[model samples]
Target: MSPFLTFKTFYTNPLNIEYFYIFLFTFLLALSLIAITYISGKIIKADKTHMAAMLLGCVFPNSGNYGAPVALFAFGAMAFDYAVIIMVIHAFLINSIGIFIASFGSEKSTTAREAMQRVIRMPVLYGALLGVLFQLLHFKLPPTIMEGISLVASATIPTVMLILGMQLAEIKPQLFALRYVNSVTVIRMVISPLLAALFVIFMPVSDTLKSVYILLAAMPVAANTTMLAIQFDVKPNLVSFTTFVTTLLSLLTIPLTIYILNMM
Candidate 1:
C-alpha cells in the first residue's frame, strides 16, 4: 500500500506552509533533471526510449523505502517527518509527470491528451489528493479505521524491499550496457545531490530539514522507475541495470553526502 493512504501520520496534520519549500525544491530538482536528460539526449542523438529511461533514472529517486529509513537512522526521528513530506511530493510528481514521460516513450505512440488521460486514471494520484482534501476539511477517520489503515501501511516497507529484490533479480547480467549505465548513475548519484545541496541553500527551512532533503535527493535511481520502464517498454534493461548500479554506489555516496552536509 502507498503511504499516501495512511490517514494519520501522513495527512492527518493540517497543511503547513513550510512544506511549500520542500515542494518547490523537489519540483526544481525534477525540472532540472528533465532538462538535463532531454538536452543530453538531443546531444547524443538518442532515441525517445533511452531518453525516457534516463529521465526516470535521473529524476525520480528511491525516497520512500530507501530514503525514509536512512533519515530515521541518520538524523533521528525528527528528520523522518521531513523525509515523508518529501516522499509524498515525490510520489505525486513521479506518478503524474512520470506517466507522461513513459507513455511518450512507448512504441504505441500516444498524443499529449492521451498521456494526460493516463495520468488522470492513476489511482495513487487520487489517493494523495483525497488525503489532502480531507486534511483541508479537517476531517479525520475514526480511530478504529485509522488503526487498520496504519496496519496496512506498516507492511509497505517489507513488501517494497521484496519487490526491489525481485526487480533486480530479473535483470539479465549479460544485457548490461556499461556506458549508458554509467551515464545514469553519474547523474543520479553525483549530480542530483549537488543540485540539491545548492537548492537548499536558499530555501527557508531549518538546517535539519535541509540536510534531510539533500540526503533524500542523493538516493539511488528509484525502484519504481524500473517497473515503469518495463511496463512502457522503455529500455527496461538499462533502467534496471542503472537502478542496480546506483543502489550499490549509494552505499558509498550516501555516507559521504551525509558527512559533507554535516561539515557545511
Candidate 2:
C-alpha cells in the first residue's frame, strides 16, 4: 500500500530514462547471483534451509536507509535519487522473489512452480502492479489516504529492525558458521560490486550513475533478510549473524570500494 501510493508520484519529475537501465542491472545481477549461490549450495550438498539463508545473505542488498544515505554523502543529491530508484526496485524484488525463496526452504517442501505460485499471491506484487497502474492512469489517492498508506509503509523498517534485535539476542557461539559468514561477506562486500563495476562499463548510463550502482551493489546484506529468515524459520541465526557481520565489515569495504572506483 505504501509503495503503491508512493509510486504514484514517480512520474512527476525529471526522472531519467537511464533509470530503466539501472533497474535492469539490479534485477539481472540479483538473479544471476542467486542462481550461482544456489548452484554452489548444490555442489556442496548444503541443507535447503541454510542455502536459502545464504542466498539472502549473498544477494540481497541494503539499498534503502543504508545505501541511500551513502549515496547522498558519497555523491550528493542526484546520486541519492538514483539510489532511491534502485532501492525501490530492489525492495519489490526482495519482497516477492526473496519471499518465495524463503518459503521454499521452510520445513514443508515446495517445487519451483509452487514457489512461484506463492509469489504471485503476495500482496506486494499487487502493490507494485497497482502502483505501476496508478502511475500510468495519472491517479492520486486523497492526501489523507496516501498519508495513511505511508504511515503503514514507514512501520515496516522499524519492525524489521526489531526482528533483527530479537534475532541478535538468540545468537550463540554454536550458531555462527564462520565459513559461510566469510563467504557471504566477501561476496557482498567485494565480488558483487566488482561484477557491477564491470557490468556498468557497457551500460548506457553516465559514469556517475555507474559508480552509484557499484556503491549500492557493495551494500551489506539487507536486514530484511533477517526478517525473512525469522519468518520462515530457516536458520535465523546464520542469516542474522551474516547480516550483522556484513554490515560491520561494510564500514571498511565501502571506503575501499570508493577508492577503487576512483582509481578506475
Best by lDDT: 1
Backbone clashes counted, model 1: 0
Question: Which whole-number lDDT from 0 to 100 does residue 27 have in model 1?
Answer: 97
Expressed as tens digits, the lDDT of each residue in 169-234 for candidate 1 is: 776655655556767887888888889988988998888999998999899998888778888899
Model 2 per-residue lDDT tens digits across residues 1-264: 335423532533345678678778888889878877877677666787878888988889988657766776788767766776677778777877888778878975546686566556655446656666666787767889777666775465455445545655665544565667767787788778978987897798877788889999999998778778887887888887787777778879989887887787
Estimate the lDDT of model 2: 0.74
The local distance difference test score of each candidate is 0.79, 0.74
Show model 2 residue runs off by greater than 4 Å: 1-9, 108-174
> Candidate 2 — worst ten consecutive residues by lDDT sum?
4-13
Judge candidate 1 at residue 256 and give its lDDT.
93
With a 3 Å backbone cut-off (N, CA, C), the pairs that clash in candidate 2 are: none
Q: Write down the TM-score for model 2.
A: 0.76
